[model samples]
Target chain A: MEKIVLKNVCKIFGDHPQKALKLLKEGKDKDEIQAKTGSVVGVNQASFEVKEGEIVVVMGLSGSGKSTLVRCINRLFEPTSGEIFVDGQDVTKLSREELRQFRQQKFGMVFQNFALFPHRTVIHNVEFGLEIQKSDLSVRREKAEKALELVGLKGWGEKFPSELSGGMQQRVGLARALAMDPDILLMDEAFSALDPLIRRDMQDELIEMQQSMRKTIVFISHDLDEALKLGDRIVLMKDGAVVQIGTPEDILMNPSNEYVAKFVEEVDITKVLTAETIMKKSQDVAYLTSDGPRAAMRKMKNNAIASLFVLDKQNKLHGVVFADEVAKLIEKGEKSLESAIHRDAAAVSPDTPASELFAVMQSISHPVAVVDENNKLKGIIVKGLLMAAIAERGGNI
Target chain B: MSFELPRLPLGDGIEAVLDFLVHNLAFATKAFSAVADQGIRLMETAMMAVHPIIMIFILTALVFYLTRQRGVTIFTFLGMGLIWNLGLWSATVSTLSLVLVATLIAISIGIPIGIFCALNGYAYKIVRPILDFMQTLPAFVYLIPAIPFFGLGRVAAIFATVIFSMPPAIRFTTLGIKQVPKELVECADAFGADRWQKLFKIQLPLAKTTIMGGVNQTIMLALSMVVIAAMIGARGLGGEVWRAIQRLQPGAGFEAGIGIVIVAIILDRVLQKLSKS
Candidate 1:
């Protein structure tokens, strides 16, 4: 389901926006229109869609209009011309009052500078949106408390925004947005002001929250690495226009133009390619509860592998059974593959970075098992496949 | 030969307008002035009833409570004691009441107008020139119409002082609100805050220090106009200085002038501390 769709949106900032917009429609570029009409084109006929439960990062340099574009989604910056549809409703057609009400119910926003009200306590800042919506005092307070807890500031509610560090202030910002429980989150360079380490933690925190919450998010950023880390699909914008839109691998592997290629060229692929992206499908595995030692041995033989991953009825990774152990168990007439299963096999969550795989794989002789949160086997990463995945991505493997 | 431009009738035109306003508006103005006169007298009597020693202690306590600064508290205590010792305690109280009432009126009107100007560009454009004219006009100019409207009393003096001191509060308020960070305004808007919500919740709170600075300036401006107000029968410390000057008693003039200075400094320090808090 599409949550937000912007069509031919153009934002001309000046006294004569309509005149500049007319020139824009006549195929005049931003500079020509600016020189001719003295109107700067903030966003020039940019179009994009954000799907429900997907995070789409709008990445660009300083003047690329990413911020303007995101603001246009909620009509914070009214588009000079074009349609903005959110959940099938035309947002541009809304009256001022209607837009205010619509924003209260549909969207949440976080800003780069944290934009927390210095006069407000942390909990009060978080409660602002709910209070605007006229929610009950008790209800909003409970929601605000829950939001603060969600952002890991459980006991810092009474502190003013200035009392917190930059990272914690941003957490308050995120909590402020989350308190509204809006369907879509528009984050404008939300973590750009933080130190690199804190920024990374915030990115991980957002991703972790998104795993269960699954709210549609449109994140604006200038840093390529941040976009790659957080965006499910990346939108590369330039000079007030969207140049390319694709998944991280699609963008890194096949940039639409030289500008995008250069933008992503400096990024280290090993840090981005996670186990989920690089791991191959496991060819053979034996059920620990149902399969006998002979079945494990036969499966390993058929796949021409020395060992086979063992799983129970729930498809959880029980362990790995080496062919030698299986053969010994078969010679001893052991019926269950559990006797042959080796529980010490190395495993990694699917989201672990490929760079970390190198460290984990160095000490393990067998293939690393890629598992989900429930320890269910998702894929396998043999050493050769990991190397090939890196080399294929143009890494210095 | 030098050609002279025809002398504009600007002064005559203003005089005519003032004449018309005086004729048509004096009834309402006089009624308001009576009420204001009664209020000032009431306040003056209430404040004067307190013993000078008691008043000094009360004021020092207030300063200490507000500022929590040992230096300022001591200065306030000594300053009030010196003014009392100079036999100008009653005169100082009158000046304090006049300045306080005028400042309160200026702030009450100025801040809202400032907020309106900040939010509406058209209002600001229209008001900006008027504010500049009010600020640049000689302070005594307000006394002319004030005399006819309020009839030569503390009310008339307060009228002129309010007009003279109001510009800073209005100008500062508009500037402070306008200077609130663009990103913060955007954040407020993004959260769907209404006009009132945005003003009270974000803009006003952030602009507090600047607004307070403006109020402080208004009070100081009001104080500066005291001697001029004395020319219109608004007697206080200004009256004592006026009498001394007329009699050529330089010692008495200095004593009264120093008394005004002490009062101004104490008020300024207390207001400065309040603004910071």
Candidate 2:
């Protein structure tokens, strides 16, 4: 089920939103509506869904509606029109008190500038949400300590925000959100304030955090690399509307528009497109010993493939056996096909980049077997597919 | 060429209102005046009970404690000695009592009004001109109405002092709170802090330095109005200064004037120390 669904959410910034909304419904452009009613469209019928435990990154430039879209989900901006459902509850239609309660109980937000309270110590900052809920002191302290520890800030709880470095302050911010244990996390450019090195560190930390916490997160970012690295699905916005929505590979391979194309034009597609995505998953394989040469011949005949992957009884990859090798083994009446298993087959892990695998692919004529760490065959990456995937890397991040 | 415009009768309208208040709101006015009288008398008696030498020592100690400046502390003790040598210690006590009571009352009312102005733009618009008039009106003009309503006494003196001293307290408080960073206020809102929580937790603490500045100004203005205050029969160093002026004794007037300056400087220092964040 979708954890959050934003259906045709529209937000206009001006005194006469109703009049501006009329023009918006009439399909007037943002500039035309703005000129007529003196209103700026923040989000124009932006719609998307975030599945449970998915990290959906909203990406855009400075004037894009990405920030406005995420804020509308929590009713921070009060979208002019449209419905927002969070975990099946109509968050858009919630009363003010209900919205406040929803924000407190369900949403944990982190910001770009690390909005830690200056007056509060690190522990107290982390405990702020619990304090708002009027949780008892002991419980707040316990949860705050755990959260600080989770963010690698266990011993620094007594220090105020001013005493901490910029990176540490942002860690405190992350801990503050984590301390709440909320179902949804809304991060609005949460690491943009840090330096590039620290930014990468924070991204890695978030990647690690989302693994265990698995909170449905809607992260807003302007950096394409950050979005591509973190998001399961990216919603790229431009001019207050959704420009495209797709996985990193989908965007890199087939950009929906010229705008999406330009956005991905500078990105290194190899870093974004993993070996698992590049490999063909439909290839057939034979057991190393249990499925003999006869079985391999029949499988190759049915699939009309020249070669097959030989696997052991445990499904561990033994080697690749060609159709001719299997047919010769069957003609010799050898029930055991151990001699047919060629152990010199080239293998690449699923996480190995297509760039790194191209050197191996160049020396071999057969498909490169993409395997897991356990030597089990996952899929195959053909030379033609690798060349095409690499050729499709014209876009930027 | 001179052009003649009809007189506006604004003064007459104010006089009529005051007249109506005196006649119709006699009981309310009496109750308010009585409460103020009791408070001033209480502070006066408390100051009087201590010996002049003991008071000087105590003032020196308080200065030392608050400011932690040995130079300022010694100067405070010497200043109190100068007032005592002038034979104006009793009158100094009375002046201290009046100024203290007036400041307490003014700040009690002014701070809330300042907060109101900061929070509500409509209230600020209404009170902006009122505060301007209160701060700018000549000290003598306060007595014209003071004589008719409160009749010449410490109550009238204190009433005038309150009106004179209140504007700075209100203005500084409003400025201080309004100056609190918008981002911090937004952060507070994002955290779901209620209005009162936001005021106390975020706004008031950040505005501390400036608000104390307002209090310090109010105290100075109250002391500056001392001589005018004594014209309404309020006893103090101001009374001594006024009496010496009436009798044309320059020597006595100068000594009393010196005493007022000493008290003003010492009080200003103590308040200044308290204001630091």
Candidate 3:
């Protein structure tokens, strides 16, 4: 089920009503108004659904409105106009008291600066949300203690925020949010203020928490690499609008626009795309010996094999022996498979897309073999599969 | 040959003002009589309500103990003894009681006003200039108008001292409260603290130091008015000093001044320690 959804969300700022009206009247598009007045349309007609237990990351640069977008989701800053539904309830129209109640029960936000009360001890700070909700003192204390324990700050609960290091203070902030037992956690650059090493640790910690709690999270960050590392689904935003929303593989291989492509260009595709993407479907055809020229040709003619995976009895790929190579083997009257087979064959898994596969193929001077787990032959993706994928995409096949 | 000293305009104005003050001695006498009657009543009430001598002894002992200096203790004891020796012990106690009462009242009124001013820009705009005027005006200036309204005695002294001392307390309290960090306020807000909760838990705790500075200033200002208060019929070491000065008894006047200094020192030290604590 979708946990949160935004429909036609638009956030425009300025005192003048006619400013937006005048822009519209003058046929000056959103870009013009955005540039002219520096009155940002923070989230422009943004529409998306985040499924339950999904980690959705909103990724952008500093002025891309990622922070504004996240804040608008919680109505920390009210949207200019939009419908926001969290767990199927339209929360935009909620009264102040209703909104407070909703926030108390449903949402937990961790800010970039941690925002822990300096005067309060860690325990008191963590218990603040519960206290505001008017929980009994003992119950609030117990819950706060448990939350501190959850955040690995059990013994340090009595220390004030100033007494703790930056990372520890951020842990207290997290504990405060967790004490509310919120359904959704909104992290607005939660680890952005930390040092790079600490940020990596915090990212790991968040992932661990998400693994156990299964809380739906919407994390905002300007760091693309952080988004790639933490996000189950990334929404790349530019100029207050979503440029692309997809899995890491989808974004890495099939970026929605030039902007998104530029963002993904420097990423190492081999690390991002898995073997499942480009691997061909398993076929029932027999494997061929490199020297068995007549038999390979016969098999190729009968099965219409573009190329056959050369494997020993263990089903491990030795190399790919193409039909043309088999024809050459036949001409040379080769008997041994080793002599006829090309040992240096480019290979990809089913998960690899055409872009990566083509790149790999271009670099290697051999037909690309498709293989599955345990290095077992699936099917050969010679120039043909790449051509088909490229053709299907209406490009240079 | 004769040398003539030139009479400056300012000096002439001063002499004229002094002559006018001397001519108004009758009104001063009337005001003093009224203050003396009130002082007697207050002392009788204090004696009946709480043993004044015992309270004085305990306060002196506490001051001496905290100060840990024998000179201060001896001076305090001798100052009280001198007031008793001058036959003004009861009147001095009455004046001390009135000052304390006035200070307490001022704190109660001023702190809230200060906090209000600090919180609201409009209130600060309105009250700031008034506080500036209150602070800048001479302490004796407060007595001139106060005499006609309250008719002298403990009420007039209290009215004057309260007006003189309140500005510092209010201003400092407001400044202290205002100086609470913005991050702290935001933290409280994020934690869902309501207005009252935020003020009590966050702002007040953080502003404790600054507010105490204000309180200290208020106490010191009140002490400074102790001698000036005698002109309005405040009976204390101030009355003794006034009597000694009138009789041209330098020894008595010096002793009375010493007594006033001792009391001021003890009170100031105790309040300073309290502020630190």
Candidate 4:
């Protein structure tokens, strides 16, 4: 089910919005409309849909109207024309009172600058949305406390926002939004104001939280890497119009225009290309329960490989067996492959980024093993394949 | 003779408007002034009934409680003691009472108008020029119409003082609320705060120091009006100063003026301390 859908939404800011809107409809672009009618187009016919429990990132530079586009969904900017549907309800048609109620009940928003109330204690700031919703004091306090705990600020609730560091302040901001327990979260550059290291930590924390919470999120960001890391599907916007909306891989592989290609040109490839994307499927593996050292050695010789991965009968990875070790085992007449297997091979989960694999690959000459969560052998990542995979994905090695 | 420009009846027009207000609104103004007069008198009597030494001790205690500043507390104690020593205690009390009532009225009326102006552009558009006129017009000019409506007493003086002092409170309040960061306002709106909630919870709390600064200015402006207010029989330090000037007692005039300065400093300091916390 779609959580949010914006159709032909437009937001023109000026004394005469209708005039600019009319000019926009007549095929005038943002600058032309602005010049012709003295009205700035904030968002121009933006259309997109966010599915349930998905993080749809709206990515753009400043003045691209990504922020405006997000705000319009909640009726903050009030779309000049067109429909906004959230859970099948027309948000644009809601009256002011209805809209307020809808926002109070459904949407939780987080801001870039950590707009925590300075006068309020961390818990009180978190409880702000509940207070507006007219929840009983005790009930709101409980929820606020739980939210503070969720954001890893469990006992810092009594402290004022000013008392905390920048990172902690934004944690309080996230707590404030989470305390509302709303279905959809609209995060407008929520971590952009933090230091780079703290920003990455926040991104990881948000991803961790999303795994369990699964709230549909529309995250707006100026940073391409952030969008790629956090978004299930990324919406690329330019000059108040959505240029492209697709999965991160789809975007990197097939940019719809020169602008998008330029926008994503400088992204760090190692961070994006995962071990699963970089690893090749294993051709052959010796079963520890069935195959002896001689069979493993023959398979390695036939495949023109120095080593072979040994798995148990259930296809769970045992370890890698080198040709020389197998030959030694064969000379000693060892029946079980376990005697020949080197159990200390480095293994990475399928989702591990290629950047982490570089360190693992550097310390060892053997291909790195990619395994499933159950330790089932999935594939192997060779040193040459890692660079080749990244280059194949349109990244400079 | 050279060509003559047509004479504008601006002053005459103002006089006519004042005349109309005096005729139509006298009963209402009189009723309001009577209530205000009673309140001011009650406060004055309560303060005057206390011994000067006792009042000094109480005020020093208050200053200490508000500021937690040893220096300010000592200043309050010594300042009040000096006023008592100079036989200016009663005059100081009277001036303080007049200022208190005038500031109360100014803030009560001014703050709402300021908030209204902040929220409504049309109202601000109408009120802005009027505020300018009220602020820039000579403080003494208010006394002319004030006498007809409030009838020459502390009430009339208070009327003039409120008019003189109220502009900063309104201007600063509007500025403070307007200066509340756009992001904070958006945050409040995002959280589903209504107009009243947003104003009270977000805008007002954020704008507090600025608004308090305005109130401080209002109090100081009220104190500045005391001598001018004394011209209409509103007795206080101003009345003492007026008497000394007439009798050519420059020493007495300076003592009363210094007394006013002491009161202004104490009030300003206390307010600043309070706002910071």
Q: Cα miss at A152, model 3 (Å)? A: 1.4
> Which has the higher DockQ value, candidate number 1 or candidate number 2?
1
Query: What is the per-residue lDDT of model 3 for residues B1-277, given as tens digits with 9 covering 90 to 100?
Result: 9999987799678567756665676575456446544655665576546554665577569777777767777766766666667656665566566667667757877999998998899999999999989988778888876676557666677768878888988898889888887656755655556778778887888888888888878877876775788888876778778888789999878877776676677777666766775
Tell me the DockQ of each model, to 2 decimals: 0.84, 0.32, 0.29, 0.82
User: What value does DockQ give for candidate 3?
Assistant: 0.29
Query: RMSD (Cα, Å) of candidate 2?
Result: 4.8
lDDT of the candidates, in the order given: 0.91, 0.87, 0.76, 0.91
**Please, what are the lDDT tens digits per residue for candidate 1 over residues A91-204?**
999999999999999999999899998888999999999988989999999999999999999999999988899999999999999999999999999999999999999999
Worst 10 residues of 4 chain A by lDDT: A388-397
User: For model 2, how does the per-residue alpha-carbon lDDT over A1-397 read when each residue is reduced to its tens digit?
Assistant: 7999999999999999999999998999999998899999999999899999999999999989998898898877899999999989999888877777788888888888887878778998899888877799999999999999999998999999999999999999989988989999899899999999989998999999888999999999999999999999999999899989988767777899999989888787767777897789877888765687788788889988888888777778778878787788888998877887778999989978766787887897678898898988888988878777767665221
Per-model TM-score of chain A alone?
A: 0.91, 0.82, 0.70, 0.98
Q: What is the alpha-carbon lDDT for the whole of candidate 2?
A: 0.87
What class would a CAPRI assessor give candidate 4's docking? Answer: high
Q: Which stretches of candidate 4 lie over 4 Å from their true place?
A: B1-7, B247-252
Predicted structure with the largest TM-score when compared to the true one: 4
The predicted structure with the larger TM-score, 2 or 3, is: 2
Docking class of 3: acceptable
Question: Candidate 1 residues B1-277, lDDT tens each?
Answer: 9999999999999889988998998787877687667767877998888899999999999999988999989998998899999999999899988898888878999999999999999999999999999989898888888987888889999989889999989999999999999988988899898999899889999999999999999999999987679989888999889889889999999999998888888889989989998
Using DockQ as the measure, the top candidate is 1
Q: On TM-score, who's better, 3 or 4?
A: 4
Against the true structure, what is each candidate's TM-score?
A: 0.92, 0.87, 0.69, 0.96
